[model samples]
Target: MAGAGLKGARERRVRTGGIELCVAELGDADRPTVLLVHGYPDSKEVWSEVAVRLAEEFHVVLYDVRGHGRSTAPAPLRGGFTLEKLTDDFLAVADAVSPDRPVHLVGHDWGSVQSWEFVTVPRTEGRIASFTSLSGPSLDHFGHWIKSRMARPTPRRIGQLLGQGAKSWYVYLLQTPVLPELAWRGPLGKRWPKLLERVEKVPAGDYPTPSLPQDAATGAWLYRDNVRARLSRPRPDAFAHVPVQLITPTGDAFLSERLYDDLGTWVPELTRRTLPAKHWVPRTRPDQLSAWIGDFVRTHEEPATRAPRPVAEAAVRSGVRPEYAERFGGQLVLVTGAASGIGRATAFAFAEAGARVVAVDRDAEGAARTAEMARLIGAPEAWGEAVDVSDEQAMEKLAATVAAEYGIVDVLVNNAGIGLTGSFLETTSEEWKRVLDVNLWGVIHGCRIFGAQMAARGQGGHIVNTASAAAFQPSRALPAYNTSKAAVLMLSECLRAELAGRSIGVSAICPGIVNTNITATTRFAGVSDTAEEKRRQRKASRLYGLRNYPPEKVADAILGAVLHDRAVVPVTPEARGVHALSRLAPGALRALARWQPPA
Candidate 1:
């Protein structure tokens, strides 16, 4: 019991329904109690990572379900794991752990399945404060969902049913009489951990404890006793009495995201969050899970009369965009050069998706304006920071401040840049230094500072670097700008390869000529006087304005690149064409590069 991998946990035994349950406690008992329940083929150790994190602010408790870890199994395996008995086990654990106070419930997989019962049943009302469920759905709601789809038999419904049926292939196998038990007690149990590590990306360690063989062998009764009967006639009165947070793993192999389509009807107060992860999220994505769980628990820890409102209601009140809300909601996003152009537009896009934004720019007033607009656009929280991204010390301080005040950044956008136009020989050393400082060095500083925080946190994150069409498509008139952007593009590719195993994604977003203010400030190196440089700037700005491409489109491309984990994304039509031609027709690109533009 002591070697279950939960450090500093106090162990205890609870007798309920003729089984001795193994319960572990962390943090001060007087704090708000957070009860963690493990899923099938797992034990209390499954919650070990999350428990340690939650213990800082709450009294965290985790227990083995009957027959799983150290808990004793019922006499007969046939009818031992019913929902009713599981409910009793939960109530008994709740009473023993936090007798005077209602415990906030958190569950994963089958643990969530049964906790749904504990939260919905009339007998357990007021005993549980709130519930956070992951990768699992209520069997009753699932039953009704299946029935409605089957009865209707429309093309879409039939397709959803078939898709879900295919995902549930393992369920059918588990329902077989003695085969599942025999397999689990034999080679299957021996290889289960390796399979999870390879397929689910779950870290290999003390999890899926040595008790797995017997635990899985006996846990078959969980499905055998309940699934068939429940699906045939699900309880219609199953409605949640408390607020529920559903964390859906978008990459979960066993469950379809559509299963929770109508979940709002069953639970009056529902918050939906989606993670880009596979099923064993407890092991693979503990940092994000712990943060979400802690946030949900803390919000609900308030008195019942003033419990924090559901995220959907808050989003509606705050005018958050519904599209991609599940993916970006409550995530922290930091964008450099967020004061104007593609940076500002990208900040607004993430704001609309409900991300908390840190708008950073060298211009203090511009950054502040962007942050204010971001708040109005739907970011739950937004802040402005004035820092030159080219300055490593400034970026380091900014990173420390953001981490201290806003937790680890989930997305970093290195979009700050300066433009210079001249032939290779005409471009001066000063002009090259200035352009590289802002474009190349700025991106380097951003990646080094914020990216380190993401990697150190051990949770996955994404980085977006704004390159230009000239990165791959050569332009003799824009030698300094082209060189800087090309370096950025290559750096992004290198970082993407280096960070792949750490779950950090890097994307280089290359945009063609767009109507933005960069042209207005672009330096012309060959100009003999300030007046000539000004004239050249005006001419370039006019040309870009005539093209009339919007920065918002580039912003959309940036978001899409991160979502898809793309390495190199060319945004506009011409950019895509040139990117292709650069590889397939180098002579054509070189010929095009030689053409001089009107000054």
Candidate 2:
């Protein structure tokens, strides 16, 4: 109940259809207005988390539908609460709030339902500038969708209909006359909050106002008045006149993703975004919601100011697929060791996908360059931070600054590491410590600090730790490196298991040997002659160059691993072969480890 109230909000009342709506405004009225609509059993306060965040950039507005919150209900709830009345309430609020300028409309659940009506219908055309919809579809669109599916009746189409029908169980229940109202006014009202927290993971805030019981009771009329009528005979000319941003929560309990598969047919300009969240996204994923909503609204409002960059060439150069853009666009991604090689390629890839990139590395100049190129590629924003991942305090400070400046990170890559090559007996304690500090401890610091931030946010995230194939396939020439990488592999596996419940995925990437500058600077222990060590370094570099495995492929593997939740991805043919051989025949790997390379 803590976040159940709005802060510093100026409140007003707008009367439209015999009932008055309670409206709250935040931020400067001069800015583009972002009007938020709430769903069934919820007031505008359901958007408390998101509205406060959006207020930083836009004029944020939230209103209680006539029957909910501080708003006055109709003389009789039965005949009120239809989409038509809802549209009237929306327009009244819009005119009262912004009058001259069109408002950017954002809706969740029931709010989204009525908003769909607002954007598509003829009357509300010029009033709404843009619409960002999540967890709700237009009733008219829904009607056509069902009719199309029923008419076709293929096995796949039938499955989709059934899947959607099962998800609409609550919608059906809401249509019952006095039963839903009775339930809401009684025990169901008392248990609803905890049920939402447990099932939807909606953060407890100034939401689900005390008017919940009555709101839920009267809210039943929304479905009772609309669903059957609209579904049976949806309006034919229901095409959207404005740009539509559809945000789908993949895990929504009340809606099926398949419902919007053919949404492109109705809207000329459409942008699609998907969230790995439940039904109540505004409460559960506010940071993500605010960022996306702000971006979408800004792009449409100031097209001249936010002009397109030359990303077509960058996209081709980076080899980024369109599918990745759908998933990572607008997400904040942080990568350590992002200055060069695999890390640089990975940063560029995410940038091409339209992510905000934070490039961190010990080489400050390199990191800055990477960030600059990331922005050029397609990242809306990019920054460079200099830090040694081995330094725990530095890493902690970096995490704090990133969170304060960039919002919560949606993806984190622990790719910083140092290479040490030597037999276990010949390797000095100092050399072993150096390798362990940068390789093993660096990953520990990153995972602990950033992973904690991701967990505390309660929104899901992904972590990628760069390991090596030497972890599974033993190597006599690389004892310290193998040990450190082995620990990282095991750590990644353990973290994956523990963080699964929190919806954080951990992936360990193991590349056998790719052409990277790490080999040029690799330490060769037990060789006292500096010239001989340099010669060995050159030889190793040459061997890797001959192998010619590009880091871009490894970067691709890293992205794919995160996308698919793959545990251990061994990149390069040799890495894959060694990984398989180790699993099938351990003795062969051990025998191979004993054959030492010439000094």
Candidate 3:
């Protein structure tokens, strides 16, 4: 309890600047050293989940800043928590732990604030090998950011300044004299963990140890001692001397992504990473943070690893959005119905973002070909699985095999479905059941099986269900198809609501019509002769071809839906128009649905 789940860790103390800093070490010391620094209102235990993970490959070190956790508080708390003093504590810890080797530095929030000081200043230049900053900006850089905006004062700059000012309301609060201390030592501290659980979606656990109250109370000095002084008279020469990896949580409540727009000027060797998470990502997203940190450390530690492989360069050369690469890199993505058309295109899109892809379809050869091409496109790893999504036992087996071999799926795209064009009375019971089985039940099976795994993992994920514009816009000729798609749309909405608390996003993709093989294979119900069904299929395919809305566009929409966590997405102009009509003029849609198409 005291260490808050930092098992098998060896602890020691290093004296610096009139205080003893509590340092905890894990893994082999002879390996590369990775030193982790904690943020405001937290302790070394804040890095417990991440430290243990990185320790598998490197010597991981975590320490309490003075006056936090088990570390002795400064005699005079007012003047003690300065960046200057914090830098000294860092050097002392580095020297005590890895005296001969430079340590890779990682910091979150206030820890990142101080670590920026440790990396930029001349005194600790050679001691730090690399710096990874999360959720915190160098106060010096922030100061410069403010001055540039004030000097230009353009409309956009003014808006950005106002937006950031609003987010910093809490910073203004912390500058208050005794209220912060009183609130922390009183009710606020008691409710902080629950507050994080509700607001940040940080999982409940043994964190924010009992020392939190005192830590929060004294941590107020972190802002007080440094903010005003550094912002007003920021060092002109404050530039990072080490390779820097800045991991920005796009949804951070405090910092704006715009804060780092000009960061390239200050950090010469910079790698930017973004995640769709909140401010407290160290706890909420430790797995991702650890993976990024370890990868960065390894690349920096061994120069041979820094050279870009052909696969690593392919995404850039192929012109995928950099944000997608940053957000989805190394994530596991599973796409159902991936043998051809929209499903294949969607799989390739995610593959281009560096996701490990699992392409599932009934056609084993087609699925394997999709997987092979996906790896060539940019995916680090990919595999093909043959299974009919309508089969529940097969899906269960697929899920189990994927978990055992590949890992928990981070994104599941239920893009598999069938085409059935027939009026309700014309469609036979067998035909209706077959359409619903694949078009509706396939999505149901994938969601029920894979979604459970995501929720149970508790790390959060995305689920995309490929519904259709027929879901909202009814047509007599497409009764069975519309019924099945409508069910999927409603199911996605319901799942989205239920999974909101778990951080899982569910999206229903509704494309009006696209050129895909489904059209050529659609069943024209009530048709007795095989020749008649073939003619109908040819006519439908020709009509779709004349419209010429490519499946690639629908694939792009699916990626965007997952990226933005949209509830319902209409891809093409026709789909958008129908969606609007369904909402605004339902009777108009009904009239249109009643009109028969040319035979």
Best by lDDT: 3
Candidate 1 Cα lDDT to native:
0.87
What are the lDDT scores of the predictions, listed in order? Answer: 0.87, 0.87, 0.89
lDDT of 3 by residue, 94-184 (tens): 9999998899999999999999999899999789889999999999999999999999999999999999999999889999999999999
The TM-score values for the models, in the order shown, are: 0.77, 0.90, 0.81
lDDT-best of 2 and 3: 3
Candidate 1 clashes between residue pairs 3 or more apart in a chain or in different chains = none
Candidate numbers sorted by lDDT from highest down: 3, 2, 1
Give every collision pair in model 2.
Answer: 3-205, 3-206, 4-205, 4-206, 4-207, 5-206
The 10-residue segment with the lowest total lDDT in model 2:
304-313
TM-score of 1: 0.77
Q: How close is candidate 3 to the true structure, as a TM-score?
A: 0.81
Whose TM-score is greatest here? 2
Clash count of each predicted structure = 0, 6, 0
Per-residue CA lDDT of model 1 for 85-124, tens digit only, reads 9999999999998998899999999999999999899999
